[model samples]
Target: MSARVSDATSRLKSRRDDRRRHRIVGGLVAALIVVVLAAGVYVVAFSPVLSTRQIQVSGLKVLAKNDVVATSGIVLGTPLARVDITAAADRLAAVPAVADVTVVRSWPNAVSIAIVERRARLAIATDNGYLLADATGVVFQTVSDRPGGLVLVDAPTNDQQLLVDVGTVYSALSPDTAARVDRVVASTRDAIELRLKDGDRVIWGSAEQSGLKSQVLDNLLAKSGTVFDVSAPGFPTYR
Candidate 1:
């Protein structure tokens, strides 16, 4: 009876030891897995393997690629995950010629930049030369000579609203009529006018009803007149 009790106690102790061993082994494995995951995360987030190796610029025409890149403020060797895309894009958008910009991470080891440059629609005469203005009335650049395929704007002041009004009127004209326009003059927002290349003048009242005014002007040009007034398209006058 004593031997049997000892044997039973030994068996119970062995089972308890096995359970403890299993629990220890499981805890060690869990710790090892956690360490490996942390190491992997560190490698992906901070290691040089995922660092920015190249900057690819696209949709650039007027602005130099190098200049855009310089202004972007994106540094090589920066971790792709750490780059502030919005900040970079904002910096790029501040470029005078850039109308819109999109910055993104080309995964693995590269950054991609897409740019939409402003198109020069009009040239405002300035002391230095002609200041190029886009559709948004932003005078982005100046040139010593007049650029081709752009209308001239003659304003007493560089008023932003005047420029925008001129741009609106010019844009409203038909392609054929737009080509005939030599210069635009606007002393005030409501006193906008256009001078044709053939020495004809258009008395455009304001930016309002510009599309209707353009259509009326197109019809009136067929008549013999030096002065065409389409301030009110419903009551056009020519002489």
Candidate 2:
């Protein structure tokens, strides 16, 4: 009986040792798994595997691609996650011709930059050259000669708002009437005039009611008149 009891006690001790060994082995495996997962996270976050490889630019007209890319300051091999899209876009927008810009990260290691340049609506005469103005009255490009198919703006001062008003009025005219416009003069905000290519003058007051004024002027042009006053389109007068 003593020997049998001794044998049973030995078996129980062996079983306890086996359980401890199993627990140690399981703990080691869990630690290894945690270490492997941490390594993976570090590799994904900081490794060059996700760095920028190329930059693509679109919607370019007057601005050169190289200039725009340089201005954007987006470097190759930069981590895709680290690129600041808003800051890049703001830098590109500083270009005088760029009206709107969007910067984004293209998946799989590339950056895409899209630009919308301002359209030249009218030309303002300057002492050095002609300044090309956009629909928003922003003077963007300057050229030595006036561009064709664009009306000239003659404002008393370099008033951007006045030029905006002129642009608004010109945009309201019909295509045919717009093509006939030779020059726009604005001595004051409320005293805007349009000189037609056919040696006719249109007294178009402020930018208000421009659409109605344009329609009235179109009808009045059918009559024989040198000066057409549509300042108050409700009561048009011509001579």
Candidate 3:
């Protein structure tokens, strides 16, 4: 009787395993059918029967619209589904001066690309060519064109902040005082000196108290004649 019970348990286990195998096979068949249907739909939707259409590009600065489209190797009437966005972005990024590139789908048969360009800060004159320096003072380009309106930076070689300090001092000056100013020079400790159009020197000590200084200069410039110096605020003395 005991042996008969053991045999019965083994048969039940075998039946359950068979049921699981059958279910798994049915699931695989269903997945295969779905995949086949999806592939068929894709072939119908984007097949050669569909005409390749226009490539749309936007947000481009450094790259010309045509160049971006051409780099994608995608021609008009080329199936949109065939264009690889990742590959297109990589190609556009290869173009010099293009800082960044983005590719996106525009549906049915259109593609869109976006490009960013490097920024130009100030261009200064050099012996042979004008050097273009970005905000961080790193020169990245040299060109033959005469770059204008950028003040030539002349400061002690040890001083690191002349360019930025002078620009700040100019910003703080009142219109009247600024108009009277001819050139601005940065000092060793970073206070800027503004050379007046009339050959007087205005010592703008540190950039800390500029609003006060502008008010004082506005009051003083009205009574100008052989002004000695206006360095420290309250004790401004002139001949």
Candidate 4:
């Protein structure tokens, strides 16, 4: 009987020892996982291994790289993970000539910026100088002299809609048709006119049905008239 009791006691002690060993192993494993996570966080967030060491810029023609870098406000040696990319993008986008911009962190110590500059669609006379305008009728740059290869437009700077209307009319013209134009003049949306390089005048009524008007004008240009009127494409008249 004593032997049986001793055997039972030994079995219970062995089971307890096994359970203790499992708990100790589980605690060590949990501690190791915590230490690994902490090290990873420190390396990613605070360590200089992934800090900004260089800035790369592309798609620049007229804009200077230094100017763009200054505008970005990204300090060198900043943590790559903590770079304020949104703020940098916003600042660069506010520039009048920049149509679109992309800012991103290039892994392992670099920041990349891509810029899309606005293309000049027209030039308008401003009090300061000639203002280059894009297809959307937004004036971007002011130059001391007129820029070549752009159709000049005469309109009130305060009238945004009139500028947009003139832009619409110009945009509708085909490349061949647009090349013939020397300048555009508009007092209102309905009074837009195109002066051809050959000293001919076109009466463009408004921004409506500009595509049809362009087509009709192309067909009408073959005929002989100093003044071409295509305000109504269905019933065009020239005198």
Residues 1-239, candidate 3: write the lDDT tens digits: 99999999999999999999999999999999999999876774667654357677777654577767788777777666677789888887776456667887677667777777655444445566665544333444567874554434334433435544544556667766666765555645445676677888777676656677777777776675655345676766555
Per-candidate TM-score against the hidden true structure: 0.83, 0.80, 0.43, 0.88
**Candidate 1: which stretches are off by over 4 Å?**
1-33
Ranking by lDDT: 4, 1, 2, 3
Q: Is candidate 2 or 3 superior in TM-score?
A: 2
Name the 10 consecutive residues with the lowest summed lDDT in model 2: 39-48
Count residue pairs with overlapping backbones in model 3. 3
Error of 2 at 214 (Å): 2.5
How high a TM-score does candidate 2 get? 0.80
Q: Tens digits of per-residue lDDT for model 1 on 172-239?
A: 99989988999998889999999999999999989999989999999999999999999989999999
Which stretches of model 4 miss by more than 4 angstroms?
1-9
Give the residue spans of candidate 2 off by over 4 A.
Answer: 1-45
In order, what lDDT does every prediction score? 0.90, 0.89, 0.64, 0.91
For model 4, name the residue pairs that clash. Answer: none
Best lDDT goes to which candidate? 4
Error of 1 at 110 (Å): 1.3
Candidate 4 residue-wise lDDT, 38-119, digit = tens: 9988877789999899999999987899999999999998889889999999999999889999999999899999999989
Question: Cα deviation in Å at residue 57, candidate 1?
Answer: 1.6
Query: Of the candidates numbered 3 and 4, which has the greater lDDT value?
Result: 4
Tens digits of per-residue lDDT, candidate 2, 1-239, equal 99999999999999999999999999999999999999876655567888888999999989899999899999888888787888999999998899999999997699999999999988898887798988656778999999887779898436878878888898898989888889998888899999988899999999999988988988999998899999999999999
Scanning candidate 1 in windows of ten residues, the lowest lDDT window is: 156-165
